[model samples]
Target: MTSDSMLREVHVRDAIGLVLAHDLTQILPGTFKGRLFKKGHIIREQDMERLLDIGKEHIYILSLEDGYIHEDEAAIRMAEALRGENLSLTETHEGKVSLISDIHGLVKVNREFVDAANAIEQVVVSTLLNNSVVQSKGAVVGTRVIPLVVKEQTVCQIEQLALQLKQQAEREAGPITVKPFLPMKVGLITTGSEVYNGRITDKFGPIVMDKITAFGSTVIEQRLAPDDRDQIVAEIQYFAELGVDMILLTGGMSVDPDDRTPGAIKQAGADIVSYGTPMLPGSMLLMAYLPVGDRRVPVLGLPGCVMHDPYTSFDVLLPRICAGETIERSDITAMGYGGLYRC
Candidate 1:
């Protein structure tokens, strides 16, 4: 159980040296080959004269010149061995909760409590990273040892809390059923003469489709419409009749004279909630709700950037929308991470 005992059990060869170098290309892909202490671990990039290494680009050199193994460095090596099995914490998961009042029914409440806790913890973490502080009374869910009055917390601390909670829960109870969330049906409206007329390929449709898939939702209907306002308006009404849950209008969202997507959306009798987002590359994103009888069909007009970049204000906001998120203008205006646009 001791650190020293565990390291010895790993039997990482005690190659006493200023630097212990290991060619990872020669080692297994994801095997945590024990704790490597003695520094001076050098990496000979790719033994290029040999077979081409897939995906390996850079080399890591672990040096012991500083002397003594930092507890963190030693621990990271061991953690590598427990890769996929690690279920770090989350603030929201698609787990169901049955109240204690229904305890007589066939359900376990404790497991759901743990899941809910994890979700809260993750949200707390997300807030912390953005420099926002949570009050003691506002501790995140599933946070072990909550009542956390800590002033500053790192990502690792958040991850550790999640891991510990998972281990403790697994010991105390049997696994509750983890249900897959019901996928919402989505409809895509691609608007642009260039794309629709083959002046340029329609890359925007696939990008939106991928987002739908990532959310575990289905793009039940997809249509390519030119910058013609009438076509856009007619199709929106047509899909409304088709009983679609959500509609996405891409391109032709800008303020250009040719941008008819927004006008057509309005003509569909859909109430525009927000005409544009404040985020760059996604400034033209629009959100609206079309009242279809008893239900409100959520509609989003994505910016042109969503086609080329994978992550944008749209990407972050879309999931929250799918989760039935309530949004204020302030929420949409806060996404200013110029460098956070990841694909």
Candidate 2:
């Protein structure tokens, strides 16, 4: 296709390959183009039809990062090429700032910073990096910044910054509000003969339960799949059919000969979100999301520590998932310091 005037468009299709801005003409006129287009740019419908003539081919656009090959889509479908933690940021006229608090040292510094700023609006804060007390007003808002730090609350702070910007925009634009998506509903699937047959007291179930609940969700369904792969897969599928937004499979996450959760998950037609988070005690964890009709239900394969430990890698992530926050590999990668690194 050829045109006299220059235009730019992003094309998205399912086929996975690498292409360039210039090569897209095979799909559409070179005039349809992008400015400052980079990897992971999302493409919309008009661009799709105009580019690949999507109806005629099996190609489906995944992301913008794939040269002109894949573009970003809002369906919450992340492409394999998308990397790092987006962490979700929003912008006002004020510059981007991270809130670090609850620790005595930075809280004072943060308070001073907020108080001094003339046009500041939102703050991203993580409290208690140290065992110090903050003497300032516990909560600050408006020209004030709320002391948003809580134990392992770094993700919460990041989320608040994103929301604060959105809220401020709504307030200024006119009254508009909508509920953020509810945390993904997760069903806990613990696989072990001991737990399933009642040989042991089912100690691990409680731990998984507590952790799930802490992340702003209730374990609406819980079950034991035993050591059988078929049973485990079936239970997971049953939960999927039940409409649980996520499924958590505890125990039997290891490479032991008896471990069947991983194999069962693969057989279940579920795509892996991630397996083996780098954090300890939960290293064997597995995360996958599968579609039930149109919505995705994430299933988690949590290892042992989700019970005994106060926090693990899952603790850092589950809330983001439960909050309907997308877990890009980068989000998990940022926890390298165990949420100790601020923002």
Q: Pick by lDDT: which candidate is best?
A: 1
TM-score, cand. 1 vs. native = 0.50
Q: Which stretches of candidate 2 lie over 4 Å from their true place?
A: 1-184, 339-343
Best by TM-score: 1
Per-model TM values vs. the true structure: 0.50, 0.50
Q: Look at candidate 2 and tell me the lDDT of residue 240.
A: 86
Q: What is the C-alpha local distance difference test score of each model?
A: 0.53, 0.50
> In model 1, which range of ten residues has the least summed lDDT?
96-105
Q: How accurate is candidate 1 locally (lDDT)?
A: 0.53
